[model samples]
Target: MKAVKWFAPHDMRLVEVPKPAPKPHEALIRIESTGVCGSDMHYYTDGRIGKTIITEPLILGHEYAGIVESVGADANPALVGKRVAVEPGIPCLKCEHCLRGRYNVCTTLQFPGGPPYDGALAEYSAVHAAFCFPVPDAITAAEAAMIEPLAVALHTIELAHLMPGETVAILGLGPIGLLTAQVARLAGAGRILGTDLLGYRVDVAKRYGVDAAYNAQTIDSVETILRETNGRGVDLAIDCARSTLTPAIACRVARPAGRCILTGISGEEYGQFPVDIARRKELTITWCRRFRFNFQTAIDLVASGRIDVRSLITHSFPLEQSRDAFELVSRAGENVLKTSVDQ
Candidate 1:
């Protein structure tokens, strides 16, 4: 088996390794495609996010799809040959959070390509059967690989409690932001606006049917949004860029009583905010965690044609070119939306 391993900052190697064996409740899958995520790029460039440092060599991919090659003795034989999109995180079922259906907050969660567990960056991966949802025949492996990110988007929108006919302003146009825009539209948001520094990303959002797109770096986002919304501001603002300036701007661009959902990954020791301004406007703010049981919903959305993630894949590299794939995603420019590694 071949895998992409991260040993240190900006250091990754594609090396041969032994294939994994599935446990009694798990399935051994022959991975077909894996997507390089923003978190993976963070680990590749900085060796860590916050205090979670990469002290040991680790496989670095989580967004993936595969075919079941073998199942545990206790597992159903019918699972064999089934194509699946892996959920990537396995929380301890014994935890209260897990029992309460909030497993995304489980204290002892094992998340692939995260702090400790290896991810699905190899030819084969052993995942819990329950965490691997069967990909419908209509969904291609490339689209299946995007289900992970789509789940993140779905979870964020759910957290926001978005309502029909609401307007939203997204402060990023990466995969997460682009997917969130589509999900918001599906949730019946009246007007979906997306912003990014890259022209290509804005173009991508436009292709996805966004009502408006902006270049945050070239234009004044808050001013433009206010004008577009007739000075009432948007009903919701989602900061998916993890940019320090984004959250503050979100507060400014949001309506007086609107909600702001911060879905980006930020490890800042302290987030400086315009407390007085937010308090004056009485804005509601929420932070998004990974996801809770949204994988199946994400797959169904794509399978039913409500979400089109197939266009999100802008680059693909075979297992032998895994290094190149990682680099392309790590240095994603205007042209790259998502990059995948294929087996």
Candidate 2:
């Protein structure tokens, strides 16, 4: 097997390694496609995301999809030829969080491509069979890889508890942000507004059907959205930029008693908030972790053509070009939305 391994900041190498054999409850997957995620960029560029530092050589890809090459005795034999999206996090099902159906927050969760566990930036990966969601024939390998981020978008919208026809403001136009906006629209949100620091991203968002898209660097996003909304503010605001300022902007642009969800992970351990404004507005603020129980919904959305996950894929590279892919994603090159690595 060949794997793309990260050793230090900006250091990655494709090297040969022994193929992995699955345990009784796992499946050996021949990875077909992998999405270079924001978290992967964090580890590649900074060598860590918050406290999850890369202290040793690590494979860095989680948003991935592949075919089942083989399965352990306990795994279903029917999955051998199935195309599936790999769910990268394994949680302790015995935890209170897992018991409550909030397994994403399980205290003992083990996420691949983070620290200790190696990921699927290789020719093969062996994951628990239960974590693999079958991809419909209608979805491409790239779109299948995208189900991971789409799941995040789905979870964020679910947390927002958006009502039909309610206005939504998505503060970021990255892959997740763009997906969030589209998912909100599909989920019955009216007048979706999207913002990004990059003009190209804003343009892309507009093309993706956001009712309005703004280049935050050139305009006061909050002002523009509020002005358009008749100064009433949007019913829901979601921040996907991981910018220190965007959360406060989310708080400011949400109507009184409206909801705000922070779905991005900031580099800083803590961020400042507009306490006075948020308090006065009585906003219901919440944060989104990765995702839980949304993979099937994400797949169905894309497979059914209700969501266009493929349009967001702006770049693709072979496994050997993993480093270049990471660089493009980290720099946020012109018009780039999502970058995928084909194994």
The global C-alpha lDDT for each of the candidates, from Candidate 1 onward, is 0.87, 0.90
Candidate 1 lDDT over 1-343, as tens digits, reads 9888888776778898999999999999999999988878778888787787778899989999999999998877788999999998899999888899889889899988886888878899998888889988888887899999999999999988999999999998999999998899889899988888888787768777589999887889989999999999999999998567788888998999899999987555456677887898999999888788899999999989889899889898887787787778767753888999887
User: What are the runs in model 1 whose C-alpha is more than 4 Å off?
Assistant: 267-269
Report how far residue 273 has shifted in candidate 1, in Å. Answer: 2.0
> Model 1: which residue pairs collide?
none
lDDT of 2 by residue, 65-142 (tens): 999999999998889999999888999889889999999999888898888888889999999999999888878889
**C-alpha lDDT of residue 167 in model 1:** 92
Best by lDDT: 2
Cα shift from native, residue 232, model 2 (Å): 1.7
Question: What are the models' TM-scores?
Answer: 0.96, 0.97
Error of 2 at 319 (Å): 0.8
| Residue 328, model 1, lDDT | 80
